[model samples]
Target: MNDVTTDHADPRTVRLLVALYPARYRAAHGEDICATFAEATAGRPRSAVLRECRDLATHALRLRLRIGPTDPAGRVLAGAAPVALALAAGCAGYFLLPQLRELVHRIRYPYPGLGLGHAVLDATLQTAYTVPWLLALGIAALGRWRSARIAGGAAALLSVGVLALTGLYPYTAGQMATMALVGALVLLAPAGLVDVTRRGRWEMVGLALAVALPMIAVDRYGAQHLLLPVLALLPIWLSAVAAPALLGRLSGGRPDRLRAAGVGLGALPWLMPLAAVAAFDRPARLHTLLQYAGACVAPLGAAVAVAGAVHLARRVRTTDPADPA
Candidate 1:
């Protein structure tokens, strides 16, 4: 006996349920899903309608990760980001090796090598800004070691410390704020840090606070000349850290080199605006920063990405495996 009465139903409740799905997915099945919800809740109270809305959101997430049909394009894009990042890091390491080696040689000599000391310091600065080693470390901690939760929690604290020390910059973008939230969420998941739950959402909230508090405090107090440009940075750094899995998701089923290029090119739009800002505002300084940051961050992203790709690939190939990668 199915009893759904029209008298207790409200149409507005069904409309909100459609917002959960990714835009492409939503466009296809949203109508059917909402229609079913409407039919089932025809005479439900306002509170019941709200409950349905909550249920729809949860269902959409479940479908995205576990049940829904896989999107190959999404996977290919996801895979390519790490590959590109890895390649870039390799090139940087090739160039930086000589300087690092010379620095080590000079450090051993009886005389103090001021030039070599400067070179080492310069190399450190270069590596830190461009390479994103810390970002990769976080990814590896999450994906491979089964210590993502612990790693993420520790990183969260360190990130706060970094943000606090660099109080000279403004945290302007909503996207940056969102990325921090995502990072926090990633940190708060079980020691594995894979599942998305209410606790996960709270983790995101905590991360947002972690990032936001420092930015607010710094901007309110005083300004300092930090070597790394803060405003131009937080967005990319946060995005890279928060959405590390995006590249893997986009790489699709057995994505090849051309597909990888396509994915990298696709990411250019979001990148172009930042590049433009860096170019116009501090062209020479930006170039120097990019060089240094690239050297450091690229290798980190590569190591983690290759590890993840190998792990995921192996999982896809076998039911039971001796090693993950």
Candidate 2:
């Protein structure tokens, strides 16, 4: 057995790896971990040391995201998973529904302005936006972390493809990229959260339906053709308004600021299709776009402000030490 305190060992790198462990775990096993890491990497080539660090980082992430997650940051990411999934699916559905309605009516491209090439582009856009994210979330819930990461990576790339397909509108493209970002976050989440229950899947599906069907209903039943954009987005508007208060109630106190922030972050992707509808999506109306945009921004803005305030206070408490009773 080689001595771990060898001079060739990179003590600083080893210490940083050890610090990635959960606080309690670090307190109990940190020295042993550092010793083992040091012993393994002493006099090793840079590439080998880098590989070792990567493996250790994965293990640390698993510990944080595993059943009964203990790390606060880990808990926040895991808690945010369901919320992100819902938002992503809802946005995808909102965009995909009109196309689906047209297909059902046997009108692939009713307008002379929308060519077959454009129809194919729209289908590809929806597939790229939606499928990989669903795959990433489902695979993670099933405890297949490697596959989840692959799916998440694919989701991110496909989302970029969706942006390119959109012809590069910065505001809408940035909004569209939110699912990619959410997918990236889930790439690190634990396997089999909530024992791999079906709850999360059903919730996402339900929200997607909730967002899409209402618009179709209003158009078909109430004869509110001009209000389709607003109807399509109304559920999201309500969610933005309701989520902060709902998170506060569920938290039973000072509000889960991190979770609220996550929900607000999740809401952003909806703006992509909303902007598209206002600017170019069929039934594009100048009249309601302002209302649509404001509905998207206001509640999310308030939630972000609160989250920022909480973060600033915590930073002050931690870094200032000026508290006086």
Candidate 3:
């Protein structure tokens, strides 16, 4: 066919969309992709065309991210994914309680100050932000891959609308951002990375409970006992310190690079709560203990990511002189 489409679709836009794929991919099927894009979106509305474009870009970006099991980022993700899911699930579960409690309180009272309107809004927000994480994690852990993706992607989009509608962006930005990242991870993570054995799936659920219960306890009562907080931080600490070395040893090579990168990615979700705790719950002594730990860790995690990128660049250069393979 000619470079231009007779069907009113913009040829230039079609070319740009196809260009987002890898050069190898482009070389193989670029023309067909462009043609199909043109044909499918030819008579669609602007919104539909944009949606198609966004979907194409997203898939292209996912490919560029090197989400396969072999790459360093992919490896780190595979290692960190379970932790991310569990922590996200735990965090989501923890936050859900207060919202439920508040909703109940508002319903029970229905006082002048505590209107039914407030209860409705809080319930909607909770459903939007908190419930989806739990749902996605459950569905993913149950090995329902398509359902997990749908649950996560839809939830993330729905939460955006809810937050925007409620006009509570400023107040809930941090929690919303954290939860949104979780949804994004669920949506974008490779199936190879997340689809684990039945035992592994159960372990993920157990870890989620391990994270959520202590956190819930700490929230319910003051930080009077150190054991609770210690238990909460234990999974992160063990995983961060042990996981990299374990992975490195298992892989049977120079484990330092893997270890370094693992430290950063692995510790991230676990440390997130500590960062918040350190900020608002400074009175808790655990925050101070974690404060010193984070200071040492923060720099290392940054270095690991930088180091991984540099290393990958060198590998790509050696493997494919023309372009990334």
Query: What is the per-residue lDDT of model 1 for residues 116-144, given as tens digits with 9 covering 90 to 100?
Result: 56655555554543234234333542343
For all predicted structures, in order, the TM-scores are: 0.33, 0.53, 0.59
Give candidate 1 misplaced runs (Cα > 4 Å).
Answer: 1-7, 12-35, 54-69, 72-280, 304-325
Q: Candidate order by lDDT, highest to lowest?
A: 3, 2, 1
> Candidate 2 on 1-325: residue-level lDDT in tens?
2432334556777788777888988899988888788778777776677778987887776775552355555555555555555555555555565666664343454447776766665566667777776666566556555676667667777777777766767555655555566665555544344223465455445554555566456545665545455645554554664356434523443665554554554555556555655666445465676676776677666655665676677767789866599
Highest-scoring model, TM-score: 3
lDDT of 3 by residue, 114-158 (tens): 688877767777777668868877887887765776786676677
Which residue runs does candidate 3 get wrong by more than 4 Å?
Answer: 1-16, 28-59, 68-70, 98-102, 154-177, 226-325
Go through the candidates in order and give the C-alpha RMSD of each one to the true structure: 16.5, 11.2, 10.7
Clashes of 3: 0
Comparing 1 and 2 by lDDT, which wins? 2
Whole-structure CA lDDT of model 3: 0.61
